[model samples]
Target: MPIRYALPNDADAMAEITCAAFAEFEDFDVTREQSAANWRRNLLAEAAERPRPHHTRIAELPDGTVIGLVKGGPADPGLGLDAEILALAIHPDHQRHGHGRALLRTVAADLCADGFGSLAIRVLAVNERARRFYTSLGGVLAGEVPPGEVFYAWPELAALL
Candidate 1:
């Protein structure tokens, strides 16, 4: 897959990827409540923003489809991690390959080089698969912040990198 910055035209695909990636969590959960409708609204709002979040990226396939994507930002009511992995997904048909890892590494390096010393990301503690993948990528749970917490400490961008 070829990775690149996402363009405005990618919005629909981005929303779709976001939805599919988080399909399991689209319903209300113990830690948080989210719906597909709410997700679509948020995605559209972000897409329409004049000054948009800079961390979202896409992975394009040989066939020209956007098969994967990764996005990051700081957690709200911020703890100052400077960065957070908002969402990362490889289409169900494209998973089990290294696209996710490559996308993450690129995002991390970009954030780190951009003067962020640390980064934080919150994965639902219940998503054991994601939690494990993150841990393997050199991330540790600084602790649980609850209610969709980005797991890390202050200067989190520094600490995480």
Candidate 2:
């Protein structure tokens, strides 16, 4: 898989991957329309931000089929994290093939190069598979929010590289 910075043109494929990936989770509530709209809005916002507070990357095959995406940015100081992975999704058909890992690593490297020392990501508490994946990658349980969300953190972002 080749990972590259996401462009505005990649929004549609990113949204489709996001919708298909989330659709597999019964606890995730999102409509296709909402997902599409949200991706567009997010991409636009990212584009408009000066100095780009966040980075979005896409993972695709050599033939140009997009399969995964990851968006990350500086985290709120209150979260005790220097940066946070805002979103990560791989098309269901592409799961378990390392696309997700590659996407995450690519973004993590970008953040690390930008001087962020630690990273965190929040996932639905009901998502055991995701929790396991994060833990396997050296993310430790960091915190939780009410109504079913948990945070995973890598205190040393360089460890991921």
Candidate 3:
């Protein structure tokens, strides 16, 4: 699995992967259309930010088809995070294939290089699969966020790598 920074041209594929991965999360409150729009906007905004948009990564197959994505960066104040995994998604067809784990490792390494001390992620308590996935990657339950989401953190990136 080759991982690369997502260019503007990759927005549609990224949106598709994200929407499909998140389709079951009705609690997220954003419609597919809204999510797509936000992805597009955020991609451009990330590019404009300093440090060059390393936060969004796209996973691709040998033939150049995108199959997964991970998005995050140094914490956003609105989200109350110092560093966070804003979103991670693998196409339904690509799940359980190590793409998710690779994404987490890649992102954690990036965050570490960027000088972040820890990385945070929020998962719905009801989403057992997600919780398991994060924990499997060494994510520690840091606390709980409102609306029934649990916050998990990986305080050290070396272990993740």
Candidate 4:
């Protein structure tokens, strides 16, 4: 899988992957149209952010089919992290193929190069597979948010690379 910076035109594909990925979670709820609109709005806002404080990357196969995406940005310093992964998703059809790992590593590398040392991500507490994945990648359980979300952190971003 090849990972690259996400473009505005990729929003629909990103939305598709996101919707498909999250649909597997019984508690997750969002329509594809809603997801697409959100991605479009966010991508536009990201384009206007001077110096690009955030990062979004897409994973695709040689045939140009998008399979996964990762979006991240500056985190609340209170979380003991300099950067945070806001979203990470791989299409249900593509899960367990390492596309998620590739996308994550790519974003971590970018953040590390940009001087972000530590990273964190919040996952739905019910997403056991995701929790295990983060743990396998060296993320430590840091804390939790009410109503069912947990934070995982990596003190060294380079460790992901």
Best by lDDT: 4
Q: What tens-digit string does per-residue lDDT give for candidate 4 at 118-159?
A: 999999999999999999999999999776899999999899
TM-score of 2: 0.90
Lowest lDDT sum, 10 consecutive residues, model 3, at 1-10
How does each model score on lDDT?
0.63, 0.84, 0.78, 0.86
Superpose all Cα atoms of candidate 1 onto the true structure and report the RMSD in Å to 1 decimal: 4.6
lDDT per residue for candidate 1 within 61-147, as digits (tens), equals 655677778776545555455677767777777676777877777777666765656667766767777777777777767777666
Q: Give the TM-score of candidate 1.
A: 0.70
lDDT of 3 by residue, 10-106 (tens): 6777778888887787876666677778888988888788875358777888677888888867765554546888888999999998988888788
**How would you order the candidates by lDDT, starting with the best?**
4, 2, 3, 1
Off by over 4 Å in 3: 1-8, 76-81
- Show the colliding residue pairs in model 2: none
RMSD each, Å: 4.6, 1.9, 2.5, 1.8
